[model samples]
Target: MIKITEKSECCGCNACVQRCPKQCISMKEDEQGFLYPFVDTTSCIDCGLCEKVCPILNPFDTKEPLQVLAAKNKNEDQRLKSSSGGTFILLAEHIIKQGGVVFGARFDTNWEVEHCYAETIEELEPLMRSKYVQSKIGNTYKEAEQFLKDGRLVMFVGTSCQIAGLKRFLRKEYDNLLAVDFICHGVPSPGIWRKYLEEIKSSRSEAAGKNTVLSLSLKSVPVITGINFREKQQGGYGWKKYGFVVQAKSPSKGDKNSVLLSSIFNENIFMKGFLANLYLRPSCYKCKAKNGSANSDITIADFWGIQKSHPEFDDDKGVSVVFIHTCKGKGIIKELSSRLDLIDSNLKEATLPNPVYFRSCQEPKKYSLFWNIYKKTKSVHEAVNAATKLTFIDVIKIFLRRFYNKLRRTFKMVN
Candidate 1:
């Protein structure tokens, strides 16, 4: 009879909700619509299975670090369309083509990040673009597992946290289930992401002569181009850098939806205040998914190293860094080889920049100081201006620092 009071410690892992044989424990949404788990005291059997399976009270240790083909900025159509690399979509397409279900994020009616099932390539198209928010997972894994049990292939793509949570929930490995998790920065809360989009659309409306399509991308801006990824090498774990411009192209222009969401909410999304809009549960900040071993079949990120190494690559064209985690992952890459225009080269030699913004551990707090300054004001327009005014000098200074450190490291290894 584990009474879950407010005083009792809970990690919000949802294990108790799943393990309860009575199905008493369920997710309860607060006024803000943030889902939190609660127990139905009347149905309590006191079996303690909930206590045993709780990842919050008893977190699992990362098995071991395994990495391969660290790439950043892989140039390809799918990579360009993806948030980082084109791998997720490629993997999803293959699974869906085989009559499997692909699960990922898509914008809901309110433009909030919500998980959806993609049964066709057209369904996957909308999901291809990165939502940059912690997408609502509405029994997606539970439903996918049922499909997997039906002897159908199911491919699920999301942040490391989502993948970890799904694997934790499923417990047993199913051959039909293919799990692909992003090598990601933390996801922004859906509420914050929605707010950011609202502000972005409002501003973009002001920018465009009239309002029309809700679209945004980082492609036009050169300063804010590089995507991040994990790069484990022969010597040790390090960063692999790649640069690509994410062009924010809207299908149509609208009075209310022209501004870039990332540009507007860039401050909060990067991290600030008591509850940074971008964080998942508090534990995600100290994620066990940090060094891989996240139970993901394939781990992928933006191939950041490509732009410099493969100078011929068009920045807007897109690039992705793919990591093959298991046999399935290797198979995915092998399959993609035909579809993707790839060049086999060690990322460090090919495109590893001097310093990476997100992957490298040497520098702390990857975001610009604008995040703190924007927190001083609540106006989303002001935040957009601040982001717009972010001088090239400031970005260059940070990039230069990272560059010099990388140069030093490269020299040491080369000598």
Candidate 2:
């Protein structure tokens, strides 16, 4: 029987959910909103297929990257919209151009993040920016496998666990498949996210002078009409200054609509809660897929140290640190050589800020207290503030770090 004794053992990959022959296993959400497989005892034949597909139970042999490079797409438009160097767009473009399909996470009409596939250039736009939420993977593994089996090239990009889940679900390797995983900090709780959205709605209604105050419950909020985490309205491509904005239909303002844009770090309650580790999935604190264990063909992330090592590549738009783990990844890079400006770079320097590459995120001592308060208050802001009371020194340290990075960028540009 496939059962999770410890929460940390399950990556929430959904591999077991999709691989069950009798359709006995289903992903059920716990109190924290993280999903785990539940086998229907009556239907389950004790086949152990679910256990076989569990990536955490049967780990893959880790393969070290063949080469590391810093790259950016030549297209200025693509680079600007991308969260990190538009490397993903370039890679996806290659597969699409070859009459193939690309799978990645994208926000749906209601602003909920989920994994889906794109076969055209237009569909790739939504997949450019980082969603920062744990995307629901709905049958994408099976869809990708079907495409590969049909002789169509397939490109899938996601966090390490997701890529590992796909590989495990497929059971066998396919030459037509290319897996690209990113250096992830962690996937935040979807249930917490729903609450956060409700918070936004409640605040917006209050601002709109509504006679009826919407309940501060996840079920009460109207469907989020729009969301933009990387809203550049005020920043003007100032990568350092970003905002998380959400739009909802206005009930009181006569259909004019309402918008909440929080540019300040302190005001962005959802972001603050996420960074404080108040509501991340328990498994994220001890990610089993880190350190290249996912066996992805290529791994990509922001080159955080670009200003110091490769000053020329530090254009403030975005730069990608790419690690090629297999010859197939190397060949893909070669094929896109004309579109990408690659620079041989040191992997150590590139991965300095991304700590998940080496180890999991350390659980804060206040983790339990934070969640307890969150359960009672149902307020993202109050919960985060209660959990992580940023002292004067802590605030100053954060300010100093941002100032130092900006100073370094300025100095590099002047010289």
Candidate 3:
């Protein structure tokens, strides 16, 4: 029987419990709020499905394909309100409408990322946005599998490795199951995210007030809302109901909030989709779902190249990128196409991703100590700060750099 010797090794994704045909495994939480797998010897068929599906045991295949597509996401309103494009929402809508249960991330009362179920398209709003923080999956797969066994359709989505991990656990496939996984980067543990949130809340205020879930808008420097948690019907959030959201900002311009410390990014503090690509679980960085080989049928992400390649696709706000890896994925596309507007750009035309984007989850130790430090980064605010700085020292440095570049160009001309 397989047992969790070190619980920290598990993210509580519950892949192992589902893969066992004998249904021998279950997850339980410990004092530190960590979850580990426990096996039921009575249900043990010993098929080794649990071991086979462990993302640690099997890594993703990272073969790059020549084609990728920039897609016009359906449900435009939700797309504009999404952490990224609302691809997952559209997929979830169809799944739930077909009487399937959708499983994804949500926050508990303490605002920690944890697993939850969305029975309808409406319930998805809270679950759809990217949390950026590492999600705690407590027996979701085991619960989802139970739902599947009773002949209920189910749709599950998460980072590619996670989706793959879920598939490996089930050991078998059913017609009612449709899985979607994202092209992930990595996920950070909740402990690290907790530290960062405390720092933000300390520097800012407890989330309150109209038009603000995080109350980030300072009257002295009113701008876009950041990480609003208020439900939309309550009229505080702009349009969508967001829960457990993370805000990435560009550096500051001389604002009172600006730190004297140097930061990256100009003064733009924008939410650049979900930060799943950042602070990943160690197994996720070395994920085995890189290629199209996982059990997940569909892959989703932002159509990064929509601006250049599919200019006609109308991202006026946002567009979703999609990869249909299997017949099941193709079927989902057909269903979605019927309900929403969609355009196609293969993997290649969408955009040529930077080297880091392709090798996002290659390894964990590959990062330096700086990785932990970078977790504190506020991207949008940093960009704004980078753009607005003109201190006395900066003036001299700019003048020198300009003069040196001019001299070098002149010398090259003469040569």
lDDT of 2 by residue, 80-126 (tens): 77777789999998899999999999988656789999999999988
Give the C-alpha lDDT of model 3. 0.58
Q: In lDDT terms, which candidate is top?
A: 2
Q: What TM-score, over all chains together, does every model reach?
A: 0.66, 0.87, 0.66
By TM-score rank, best first, the candidates go 2, 1, 3
lDDT of 1 by residue, 73-167 (tens): 23454554555546677778888889999998786755566787988888997787665556777767668878988999988887765776677
- Superposed on all Cα atoms, model 2 deviates from the true structure by an RMSD in Å of 5.2
lDDT scores for all predictions?
0.55, 0.80, 0.58
The digit string of per-residue lDDT tens for model 3 on 254-324 reads 32232111111121121221232323455554444566645577777666656577567654455666777
For model 3 the TM-score comes to 0.66
- TM-score: the better of candidates 1 and 2: 2
